[model samples]
Each structure stands twice: as structure tokens, then as C-alpha cells.
Target: MMRKTLIIALGTGLAVTPVAARERQITPYIEVAQVLTADLTNDDVLTYTTLAAGIDANVQTRRVQVQASYRYERRIGYDDRLADADIHSGLARAAVRVAAPLTIEGGALATRTRSDIRGAAPGVLQGNVANISQLYAIYAGPTFGSHIGPVGVSGGYRFGYTKVQAPSIVSPITGERRDVFDDSRSQQAQASLNLKSGTVLPVGITLSGAWVRDDASQLAQVYEGKYGRLDVLYPVLPTLALTAGVGYENIEISRRDALFDAAGQAVVNAQGRFQIDPNGQRRIDYNFDGLYYDAGVVWRPNQRTQLEVHAGERYGSFSAVGSFTYQASKTVAVRVSGYDGIQTFGRQLQTSLTEIPTAFNPGTNQLGQNFNGCVFGAQGGAAGNCLNSALQSVSTSAFRSRGVDAVISVTRGRTNFGLGAGYANRRYLASNAGPGIIIEGLEDESYYLQGYINHQLDTRTSIDANVFANYFLSGFGPQVGVYNIGATTTLNRRFGRFNAFGSVGIYNFGQDQQRSITSIQALLGGRYSF
Candidate 1:
């Protein structure tokens, strides 16, 4: 049977500094790849060739920092004998110190990726299929803060927009495709004031408040919320501190539902009846308003180790937050953390953008920066690596999640190794049903473990290998359990400004009660940098 496959990819990049002493650089790059794919199971193989080009630029100074990148890809498939697809991705971020005590920051991200529904549902998948959608998000805000005498004050207003082109999916019941696109816009304003800088107040006190509003189209869901919080801190000793915080939050969501007639067809009126909310009311399913409080201790005995632990009540539920970090030596480090939080689909994607290196710059390498440091350093710098536990796709509704992450990395004479693990439990707040799809309230538990090792054979040669396994469990209709395992090894040879590498990877994903997929691929490529 023919299966989807990405065969070989080759890329080259060039970097240039515009001015000698100024911290400004620009890089332009291009890549070409060949893929062998099948749109469905037991289908004929189709050969596809793709070409991509991008530019990355960054400027940094004492008072300003900006980074941006843009990429475009065009693909041609032999089955159609035409360039049938064009893909674009871009990200930009800027932070400027408008004044000594004031700053403005903004960021925007746009990406196009294959939708996860194709794999989650019962269907044959192809890497080069047209099941692609774009996700766009932008946020801008200004923050001003300063210390006057023995008190400090700060405030900011932020505006954000998130848009996703929800792809049509084939329904298991009707076997017909339907559209389910949605968009959301939100605004948030916050302010805070604190005391005890130099007033000998015995304990530091901070007061903060925020207001947020979100409006979503298509789903006709509107959310408004207000939050107020107060925190106090006291130093018990030179290396330890006691911390406590109390907060109140209230959120409201507009009602949304589909109305169907006796004929099993959606009812309609002059105001786009089938698509509009019949009765605008509040949706209790999305309500999460209540009072919460927490108390925690922070310990920082030295520069190499720090720990924080807190336990609290949230909306009548138990909640906790904690983090621990330890630098075992100059070449080893460890980190562990856990948190409970409420999140929307858009917010989760935004969080992933902050943790992952999404920039397309020539020098931006996630593995090299987080895992294989010894390749560029003498004794290898002490660096910590964390597993990315973010959801792969944006869900249609908001959810609550509790998760923990941990990682350990060590570098020795000529070898570097790292291990990481993460787990999360998520509860969806809403259910959705459409022409071809039905999603009920879901509670999902996911976990993964990954490890990597890099070894230098000689001055110009190195080998790196990594493996990971992920398992997911979900409750409700069509209760599902799935696990995925993948491994890859690569050997690299350096030749001044050019490098040659060969890699082989194997991946397998399967559900306990259904079909499974396994793939193997080998690639040989060269990269040149300037």
C-alpha cells in the first residue's frame, strides 16, 4: 500500500551584517524537497517537488530589539503536473523603550500547517494533501512602570486578534464535507501598584486588577471577565521568603446553539436564522467565575538552585503551582515545574510561540540550542531542555488543564545527552456538532518521554540520535487510546562554511482498537551558510 512520505529536503542560507558596529543582521535562505505521497490508503504514489524561500532579519540595541522572518513555499505534484499549492509563514516581534520607564512591545505570527483532523479521524493521510489552513495572531501593547520614593506603579493595555481558517472535514456519519471556520478578537487592560521598596513596611504588598473581553464570530460566543488580586511577601531569612496571594475573577459567556426543525433541517429566519444564535443568552458551560487564593514559599539559597511551591483553591477546586531548578555543575542542569491554568485555543498557540524557536533564521536551531551544545563549546554550557507539551492543534473551545514538565541535560568531554518528560490533563468546556462532525465534552490525558545523545567522533564529524514516545487517552464517545514512537539518527561532516549530513528516521502511530501507520525515510543533504 502507498503511504504518505517526505523524502529529501536540502537548504542553503546566507547571513550579512548591514553595519559593522550596529547589531543588525539579515539572512536569506532557500530549500527544495521531494516527497512521495498518497492522498488516501491503498492509492497510487504521487511524486511532489517543493521549493521554499525565506528571509530573516534582526536588530538589537540597548533600547530596542526586533526580530522578523518570512517564508513561502510552492509545491508541484506529478499526478497533477502543476504547481498546485502555495504556503506562507511569518513571525515578527519588537520591543522598544520609548522612555526610561516606559516600553512598547508587539508581535505577530502567521503560519500554515496541515490540520490535525485528518489524522485524528478515520481516514488515509498524505503530507502533501490540500488539508491545509492558516492561523494568524497579533498582539500589541504598551507597559509603563516606575519607582517613586518607596512605591511603584505600572499599567498596560493590550489588544489581540486571532484568526483560523477551519478546514472542512468529511463526516463519518454522512461521508460529506462541511465548513466550520471561526475567528476571535480580544482586548485586555491591566494595572498594578506595589509598596515596600524602601519604606520598611516589613512586608511588600501589591495590588492588581484586569479586565478582558473576547468576541468570536461564527460560533457567536462572547466572553467578558474581570479579575482583581492582592499579594504579600515577607522575608523570613536572607535566603528564604514567604508569599501569599488572593484573587477574584468573574467570567461570562454568551449562549450559542443550533436550532433544527422537525424535518431534521436547521430552522431559519430573515436574520440568517440557521447560522445565528436564536436566543442570545449566557452559556453556563463556559462559566468559570469564582474567588481563589494561594500561599507559597520561595527559596533561593544560592545562584544555582531555586524553588517555589504554592497550593490554593480555584473556583472551589484544588489548585497548585510549583517550580524547581538546579544547576548540578558547569555542564549539567535540571528543571521541574507544574501549573494549573485556564486556557483558550488561541492562547495555547500563543504560548507555544513563546516557548519554541519559531523563527526561520539561519542561526536559529532548536536542537542545537537546547540539546547539542557541546558541538560548539569546549566543556558545553549548562543548559536545560524541556519537552513541548502544547497541544498540536487549536481546539474549538476553551479548556482547563494541569500539567508538569521536567528535563535534564548533561554534557561531558565529547558527548552531550538530554532527557525530558511531560504530562497534561485537559477538560474541554463545550461540545460541538455539525453536518459531518460531532465533538462531545472530552477529557484527555497525554504524556511523553524523549531523550537524545550527541557525540563528536573527530574535529569535523559528529553523530546525533534521538527518540521519543507519546501516549494519549481520551474519555467519552469513541473513547480512544493511542501511542506514537519515533526515532532518528544523523551524521554530520563540516567543511568550512558548508556542511553535509545524512539521516534516517522511523515513526509509528497507532490506536489500540484501530488501524496503525509506520513509516521509514532516509535523507542526504548539504547546507551552506555565510
Candidate 2:
């Protein structure tokens, strides 16, 4: 599949290169990329490296454009003793202007991955396949202005299908089959309206909504969601402008004919942000939503000095942070910030695995149906009755969380660097389900820190590097700690009248108590103008 995509992209580029000579309208572009890396953690004997490469091409004329991309990555581990990882993905997009006020675009994307453990201990082989396909959308709106101003609308409907497969493993004790096979089909539609102000306001406001219908046998369902936003730009003064807006979003998921309940239906998202800017000298922004809110201000006292303040809230907890930045010279700048917050806890439950007994069948997947088959079992000697009891328990109280964040930055020449550190403490008690279920035990705290930097040679060339590390004292379930690092670079240039650009980044994710992930990515391509 990767080879075929690359071949088609190369062919299209060659076909569109001579459009200038033929006096025909055409645009062509291509990009290629590669990456290599290794892990240097506490282990010195086990080394892993990844390689990724890809190509992208685009061809467009006055009324139409076509784009395609393909990427492949492979991981070698244990001193090149094992082929540990692989990933392949592809994308295609095409758009055309059907009329003066209407245009259409569509695309398809797919990816697959596989993993194996050779030098490791045992039982570490894993693999999965993911595929999605969708059709294009055509949009139409008025070409002229409305009586009040310009009014326009754009929308599209998409039909998508997906299929996934995973390996089956036998329970260490029950010796039952535990592989997974899932297939899903879904359709989604979205539309939005933009009203330009010839009226009281000079800014435009847009309202949008979307709906998705997904089917997976007995798990088939429909989700409906909508949102609206009003935007306006007000000139507070010649040097300062203020932007204020608010929006409301809601989504409800319903099963076959049933009204969506809190457990089954998700609430719509409610969020908005407001901001004020005085050119580059000072800026203030307020951001908030249903669960969180923050207000930030930046003041530039001079060309070389800056001060900032940030405050926010999460539920019952509140936080505040302050920072200062100073340019020591034309080539160097430094900054520091401090933050703190408080947290509390209610009740939470730990998630664990249980074995299904011969009398009951647990079915499969998230939407899998349950039927009489085998009874279930748990770890150690605490199987059967003990496992069943735990599953039936519920909690009434909630957990409390509190945290603080601090940061600092430094920059020189074409390079800039940053450091961030934070801490979170949580308390969990017990809760009653009102009826019968009750939960118990869960108290923990965690701390984390990360740092990164970027270097840019010029507009067409730059590099970024970042690293993240996290740790937790103790938690109810799997460890929520990991280390991540990534680097990306882009190259852009022009040959005659044509222009091209491409970028590639590689990310490394150290395994956590839950799962481990590692991925290599690359993209490169260019375009020509006629």
C-alpha cells in the first residue's frame, strides 16, 4: 500500500511539471522525510531505534486540487536483534470549485501497526489494524452580500466505515479465548452559518452543529450535538483592541428509540474565551469552560522586559501564577514563573480484571452483550464470589484534586528553551450508590516536570526538541507516569515559480503501568505554480 501511494504521487508530480510550457494551469509539490532515535533509560543492554519516511504531493489548477501522502515507520530493538514495531498510514484529498459560490472536497485515511517482544520476558506480542474511509463534501453559499451585510453557510456530510482486529489470548487460569474483532459504520453531518455585520456590529458570528450515527450491531447508536458562537472585535483604543465571545455546545447519545440518559448521553461542551491586545506591548486573555477557567495577562514594559500573571480554577480548587521575562541583550532572554493550587477528594474505585466463569459469557468489546456462559474469576485465590462482589460495588462520593505549576524559559539567537514543573495531590475516600453499591480506598499524589527548546535557522528551516517526564506516588490503578521526547524539522523553498515544504517528527513514549507506545513519523513534499 505504501509503495503504491508513493508511485501515484510521483507520477502525478511528473505529469503536472510541464503545465507551464503548455500554457495550462497546474500546481505540483512533493515532500520526503526520515527519523532515527534510541532509548537511554536505566537499561544499557536494550537499545531501540526507529526510522520513518514519507512523501506528499499536491496538484491544483484554478478550480481543482489533488493531494496524497504516505508514511512508513519501523522500529528495531535489542541491538538490532529484533523487529519490534511497524506502522503504515496513507491519506488522499481532492477538492474542486463547481461554481462561483460552491466547492467540494473529500478524502480517505488509513493506518495499521504491529508489535513483537523477542528479547523481553514473555507474552508481549501485540498487533492491531485500523481503517477509515470517507466521501467528499460540497459546500454552497451566496456570492454577494446580504442586505445587512454578507451572509454565507458551509456544510458537509460524511459516511465512514471502520474495522479493527486484535490477537486472542488465553487467560492464565480459565484458558478461555480473549481476542477481539470489531466493525463499525458511521455517518456524520456538520453545517455552520456566518453572518457578516453590516448592522450594529462590524464582526461576523458563526453558528454550527453536527450529528453522528454509528452502528455496531446491537451497539448501534446515534449522537447529536450542536454549538453556537458570537464573535465581535471592539476597538477600545487606537493601540488596544478587545475581543469577547461565548459559545454553548451539547451532545446527546441515544440508544435505539431511547432518550439519552446521563450515563448514556454525554453533555454538550460549554466554553468560551475573551482577549485584549495592545499591539505587542501588553495582552490579557480570559479563558473558561464548564470544568475549568483561567485569566492571563502579559505586560511588556520595554523592548527587553515583560511581566505576566495567570489565575485559574478547577471545580472547587483555585490557582495563581506569576512570571517575569527580561532580555539580557539582543541575543539572550530569560524568564521565570511560579504557581500553586489546592485539591480535595471524594470517592473513587479501582479498575481490575476478572475472569469469566463457565456459567457466564462476558461477550466482547465495550458494547458487547452479556449472556449465560461461564462464571468469572479473579487473581490469586480470590476468584469467583470475590470478583463478582467487587464488580457490583459502586461509590457515592467523588475524589478531590489540587496542584501547582511553575515554569521558566531562556532564549538566545535562533534558539529558545523552556522548563515546566508541576505537582498534584489527590484524596479519595468512600461513597454510597444510594441504593446498594459502595466504594472504598484511594488516596495519592503526583509530581511532574518537562523541558523543551527550539532552534530556527530561517523561515524555511527550523528544529524543535522537547522532553516530558512524570511520576506519581501511588494510585488506585495502573501507574500514570511516563517519559516522552520529540523533535521536528521543516524545510521549505522555491524553485523558479514553484514552492515546496515538508516536516517530520519522531515521538518516544516510555511505557507506563497501563500501556506503552512508540511512533516514528515523517512528511516531505513540494508544490509548483504555473
- 151-218: candidate 2 lDDT, tens digit per residue: 56655554544443332222221222211113445454555566644444565454544443444321
Q: Which one is best on TM-score?
A: 1
Question: What global local distance difference test value does model 2 have?
Answer: 0.33
lDDT of 1 by residue, 331-423 (tens): 676667676766555554444333322111222221112221111111222233232444433444566767887867677888877777888
Per-residue lDDT of 355 in model 2? 16
Candidate 2 local Cα displacement, residue 197, angstroms = 3.6
- Once superposed on the true structure, which residue ranges of model 2 sit more than 4 Å away at CA? 1-56, 60-62, 71-86, 91-94, 111-149, 158-164, 167-188, 198-218, 228-250, 254-476, 486-530
- Score residue 84 of candidate 2 by CA lDDT: 61
lDDT for 292 in candidate 2 is 34
